[model samples]
Target: ETLVLTYDVIANDGDTDSNTQTVTITITGTNDGPVASGSYEHQIVDGPGADTYDDITGQLRASDPDHEVDELTWTLPDGQGQYGTLTVNPDGSYTYEVDEAAVNGLTDGDNPVDSFTVVVTDPSGASDTRTINISLSGTNDTAEVSGVDEGEVIEAGGGDPGVPTTEGTLLAVDADNPDNRFQPDSGRGSNGYGNFVVDEDGNWSYTLDNDNPEVDALNEGDTLTDTFVVRTEDGTEAQVTITIRGTNDPAVIDGDDSGTVVEAGANGPGEPVAEGTLSSGDVDNPDNVFQLEMGEGDSGYGNFVVDESGNWSYTLDNDNPEVAALNDGDTLTDTFVVRTEDGTETQVTITIRGANDPAVIGGDDTGLVVEDDAENTVGGTLTASDVDNPDNLFEPASGVSNGGYGSFVVDANGNWTYTLDNNNIAVDALYEGETLVDSFVISTADGTSRVVEITILGRDEPEVLHPVHIHRHDSGGDLWVPEVEGFDTGSSRPSGSFDRSLDFVANWLRESSEHEGVVARLWAALKPRDRLVYTSDPFTFNLQAGTFLHTDPGASLVLEATLKSGAPLPGWLYFDRETGEFSGIPPEGYEGEVHIRVVAKDSDGREAQVQFTIKVVDEQEVGMLLEETPQDDTSNEQTLRGKAGFSAQVAAEAGGNDLQAGARALVASLQALEN
Candidate 1:
């Protein structure tokens, strides 16, 4: 309201004095209310998707003519009608968005109220309101593809290579509208995966389009992978991945069918048999090689060799007993199966025939046997056999030569035990590689005289090397070398302690190599006593918060700890009856400290063990060091609690409180107290 007024007065005194003025009044009418404009109905999708910053304009503007400079306050309609927080700017521009929580509860086509009101009030208490008619709807959502049970496998050139066929179908729902359907986002074969496509009905199929770049590159065993997106009429999408596994061709093994060799014994009268090499090759894979199949021909004892690097050859193992017992003019065919890296196999036949008539000894004459106190048996059972008759008498020629050779015993009852003549020869003289051959006269048991030559091989003590690292140090803080008392005369000390240690190690290794067959025996004797000793501190790990690999191909493995006598297991995880390995995989959404106990016990009731920890979270996302017991069943698991045990069970199960956050808060409190 506008108004104005005026008044005048006059007076005289002694006569008196006074003044007079005119008075006027004009009133400004009561303030006019605000006016509303720019009002209209609008349609929008129901979600923010990934655009967190994008917003919807409310489009409501207002002004008051009576109080142009007075600020107007916008009052938005309340209740579920407002999707999200409505914010108004000073210039009267306001925004709104569909809240996920609100949208999640609303179904397609379900409308409660048809319109809402927006009120604008002026500073003078005058106000005006407008009706905003609203319409509710929903969008087609992404399809559910994980539940589709189907996979693709093809042998590049096999299985309808150029034809499109159904692999499986996809299923999806609009969530907001169950009747909404999903179809290919792109037309026909335009999905970038050759002709792989999804129809409106979610039928998935693919064809080998030779013109396509990826299809053109396909080989015998090359696996190819691709993905496609499908959508509903309302622009929603889902992705599917398809895999094509590749296979390789079989390997080709080529070699001569026959070979010739001179007649010779392996250790005595006959030696070196004829041999040949079989070459194998593979066409596709670069690391292709050969593998031998067992129980084929003479391969029962590995009569053939197939190296991982593709080398193939035949082996004549005279020491196999069967090969060594062959008589002159005897022949045998050894058949073996050889295969390529891809399991393609072929059978190879090899004929081994002796060209002379005679009994011969084969194989390395030298042999090894753990010392049985001061005596040991040596030599082979195949000494001699007559060609003309099955019955024959073989005995020591009434004359004794080389002493030990005649000391052996052979009887028709098969008593072919050969005892070393340690009594006749000094222990030092009966050394490794020592040769002793005694002649035996054979007479025909049936009186039939026949002549045949045979071979027999024997060996002497030989050196087999095995080395272990060691450092030398004496009680006097000095290094002891090779001549340290029992080792030498305790006089082989080096210029420096380190050098002395090096010399001692060298000497020890030399002795070890000379010990021949005794190294393993000694190591076996000393192993059990030290296995009970703890080699390191208890194994430990700090697991991160989040779900870990529980058979999910892409999920990260948080821990793979293995216990050992000394095996480095930081990079491997395996627990079986033999190894004392134990590891914990935290269930999905379960994060907390997990304490573990690993125990190892020997047959004598002696036990050794260690205790360790796994910090489920890298940092203090949790306020407390709450222990989370592993739940073997995902369906039976329970939510976390603010306190341990049963303290906060009811509050957690109430389903209204943030139990995870509450537990974190408790941890924070305890941490604060400690600090």
Candidate 2:
């Protein structure tokens, strides 16, 4: 069992021997940890004071070979709350918020300083630390006062003290050391000085009174002077001067030294008196003397004042009614004249108005008569006579007719009578009882004239009677029956029948009436037995569907009539039996075929006859074709041909046949026939 393994030993060492062996060895590797670099320290000084705490911020970077190390953490070994709060971020950044209470704990002195330490730790538990210093220093807290002058003074009534005075005390101080103090030096007090006080805010105050001895003693052309001194707590001072002067004013009036007086021979009851002047005198000024005062009266007395040179004048009172009424014939007695203290005179005038008497004249009545029998005669002449003048004549020499009598004439004596030619007659009636009134003037010896009216009564030949008639017809060409009729018939008549006839015609011719646009022919005719009166000649005849008759003008008559298409016919005609003349109007509704016959009598009883025929047609149908055509050149040269007849043919020819070829040929044929 004790066999030991051995190798054969070779002499030359080609072979190796086997033996038991024991060995010892060692192995080592590199270590990698966070290495902090670029770490620096900084400090922040407390504002203007001793410092007990320091606050700072800085960058800390660290690196490690091992992947497990991600960031470094910052710390303060003395703890945060003791000095202030320290904040560390994962990016290896750090901040220090120094405690204000800690900062105040430092002594209040110049160049006060404080210190602190900051530590930073890495993830590997490695840490680094640095120290920072903070310093505080004291500064000035006072202001300097300046710009104030010394030994200046201002008057008692000077303006604001803040402004520079003519004489004033200036104040100043050193502002840098926090204490404000001033003292008076060169300009302490002079003329303008009184008492001044300085406020804590560095403002100075000074007051002046009007009742001050210096101000009260200032009279016209006098001046007052004073000085003021302004000082601060620091002994700085300024000065200003004040001045006051007086002004002159005009003397005031204390009492009335002027009076007024009435002018001599210018004062009277109910009479116009000239105004008296006022007088006044100044004590020392001659030019101011004799100042005039205003007067009180109906006169314009205020204008009687003297000028600056002491000259004066008086004004009269013309407003008095009694004085205004005075004329050359009257005179004022015992009138009193007054004067002002300065002495001025005026005169009054008095007069009486004249009397007047009127003259008179008289007249008498005169008479005259006609050649006819006195008992049968209706009137005679009446004349007027003036006792003052026989040749006095009358105006309006002709007298008007009264009660249907003829006109009369007035003679130079105011006599009026009817003409002989118009006197009593047989066949021609005359006015039996008539009168005429006229006016005449009678002259007097004084060349004045008086007017009188004279009325004359007389009779002239009776008026002859004239006759009128009206009639109508129906549209059927038959006589029209009258709804109302007149009966008078005579030889002579008023010639205004046409005027009355037109009134009747207008009634039926209205746009809304049945006879609108109907053909109406007016006719006037005379019979062989009826004589034509020269004055009664017919001027115009108006036909309507009515009948009228009269012995004179203005009589209304209605005719009996019928209408066939709104036109009156012949049945409405009427004849006056005595004059043997006819007149009538057609019916309002007459139309279609119409036949009219009329017989008229003139003023001389002469009659005439007339007859007419008419056919009624529609106005719209007649002109319709004219409105619708184009009327171009080609159409204008073409003649129209159709059953519509000549009217259409003329229209087509005027249109020049511009219609279609067929229409043109037809129109040409029609035009040939028409031509």
Give the winner by TM-score. 1
Candidate 1: worst 10 consecutive residues by lDDT?
521-530
lDDT for each of the candidates? 0.40, 0.34
Cα RMSD (Å) per model? 46.0, 40.7
Q: For residues 1-675, what per-residue lDDT tens digits would candidate 1 score against the true structure?
A: 577765554544545565555667676677788887677465544442321224556556787887663387667655235545455444555665556544433544544333556777888777777665545454333333333534564533322353334366666544443434655543334335445656676676655344444554455657666566566544566655556554454456676534433233522344333344555554454434655433335444225555555444565554445554455567556666666656666666665654333332222223333222244554333333434224234332222211123234444422243454332222212333333232222222322221111112233344332233222224332222211111112232332322211212111222333422212100000011111111222332233222121111122222222322122333222243333334434344444433332333323222222334444443234342333432122463333321122121111121222221111111111111000
Minimal lDDT window, size 10, model 2: 501-510
Indicate the residue-level lDDT of 256 in model 1.
Answer: 51
Off by over 4 Å in 2: 1-56, 61-71, 77-86, 96-109, 124-126, 136-138, 141-155, 158-675
Compared with the true structure, what per-residue lDDT tens digits does model 2 show for residues 47-93?
43333444567565666654344555655554354445666555656
lDDT of 2 at 148: 35
Residue 512 C-alpha lDDT in model 2: 18
Off by over 4 Å in 1: 1-180, 184-235, 242-250, 257-277, 287-331, 336-347, 353-675
